[model samples]
Target: MAGPNAPWHQKKNHPVRRHFPFVLLFALLGLSALASAPAAALEFELGAGPVDEIDGDGTWIATASWLTGQRHPWELAVGMIGARTQAQGVDTGDVYFVSVSRRLTWKRWFVQGGIAFTDSDNEVLSNHWQFRTGLGYDFGRFSLSVAHLSNANTGGRNRGETFALLQVAF
Candidate 1:
């Protein structure tokens, strides 16, 4: 049992939520940089995968990214993460995130690394700050990739989340 004064009881006062505006500002700025330019292609991805935890079923994710018109490596994306649940159990809170990632490709095989900021906090993803990395193959109008999201022990008790994704280009 925990006392009323404990940190867990104080959601509104959490450091990340207290500083949310600053985080959102930066994320928006990064995305703006990508959207400002005329995108060569826009990509949308949908995915689901198992959560790295006990009794975890799976998690779902969707994202939108603008691929730079030329072969530029930088991309900005905004996405939503669905909550995970145990077998016939309750669901955790959903997370909304924005990320700025750079993709390096070699003959349709590509890898991406980026930093992400999330707006919600919950058991599955305890921290508001996260790091994202993934690798996959681009099959012309679509792509197959797997992305991992980690809070990096920023809030402790981190198990990280990984998802296998399918992407469509428009």
Candidate 2:
């Protein structure tokens, strides 16, 4: 059996394991923020795009997002993304993220940006700090947005990803 000097005990594998607790804490906080929002403040979005140009050798991408009711310029959102990509021998992967966005609107056009904590299953992508930005044109209850997600080179690989989305508010 390997002891303290074992390869498994090295810092590389331990990074994600060590950070698991922090991720859990952040998730909890995000949930609480969502809970605090009014029921009528929920928004849903669906997005799709090409994958390889963003992060991997995938052909297509799909994402779904839910944003909690807005408190002026601030809102909390949770998003799930799935990509059909061949990266690190995996044919598919998913990324789940929580973000706080600041939105500014003038008439029917809006711009939003925020930082996020991403948990990804693809070996080529990192499972931590990410940034997201997007702009959309709101048509009452419906909108179209173009957004991008990236680790900002915080990880070993940071190709980033982009999406074109259609959103609806209930």
Candidate 3:
């Protein structure tokens, strides 16, 4: 009899990765929809880069937006994130976070900024507070965005991110 491991093709179909940011985005969106939200939106992000010469890493993040008024292009947003990286045969860095943001729009361009509080899995990697700023363009129900996140305690490292945003109204 052949054991399950005997053949390379015998492996079952399974998901190998847990996408936390996407999960959080959907959860936040569902909550916003149920609350009869106006101009509420959710965004998800993934990132990867070199932490050092010997290693590379990735992270996932999500954010939700709420519009305060119908007339002005002012809105407030909340975000959450989960990130992890391994180096030198050890899981040496991680970040779990929550944040708040405000956005203002004019014609096709918009400017936004936010502040975040992060908890690190490894205390040595703790940066505590992170700040972000961005510029975006709106095209119908979709948009494109670019942002930067910086922290004083992060050893002069900054995270640059780009996002493709899509919105659907019910």
Q: Judged by TM-score, which candidate is best?
A: 1
lDDT of each: 0.71, 0.65, 0.46
TM-score to native of every candidate shown = 0.75, 0.66, 0.48
Model 2 — which ten-residue stretch has the worst lDDT?
Answer: 51-60
| Residue 59 Cα positional deviation in candidate 3, in Å, after optimal superposition | 3.1
Arranged by TM-score, best first: 1, 2, 3
Q: Candidate 3: list runs displaced more than 4 Å.
A: 1-55, 70-75, 87-94, 121-125, 152-170
| True-vs-predicted CA distance for residue 74, candidate 3, Å | 4.9
Q: Once all C-alphas are superposed, what RMSD does model 1 give against the true structure?
A: 5.3
Which residue pairs in candidate 2 collide?
A: 58-85
Q: Model 3, 1-170: lDDT tens per residue?
A: 44655542343321111333543564465455434534353333332222222245444445555444332333334444343445444343334445455567788777877665454324223344566666877674555666655563555433333333333212
TM-score of 3: 0.48
Query: What tens-digit string does per-residue lDDT give for candidate 1 at 57-111?
Result: 6667777776654454566777887776563544565678878888889898999
- Model 1 regions lying over 4 Å from their true place: 1-17, 39-54, 87-91
Clashes of each: 0, 1, 0
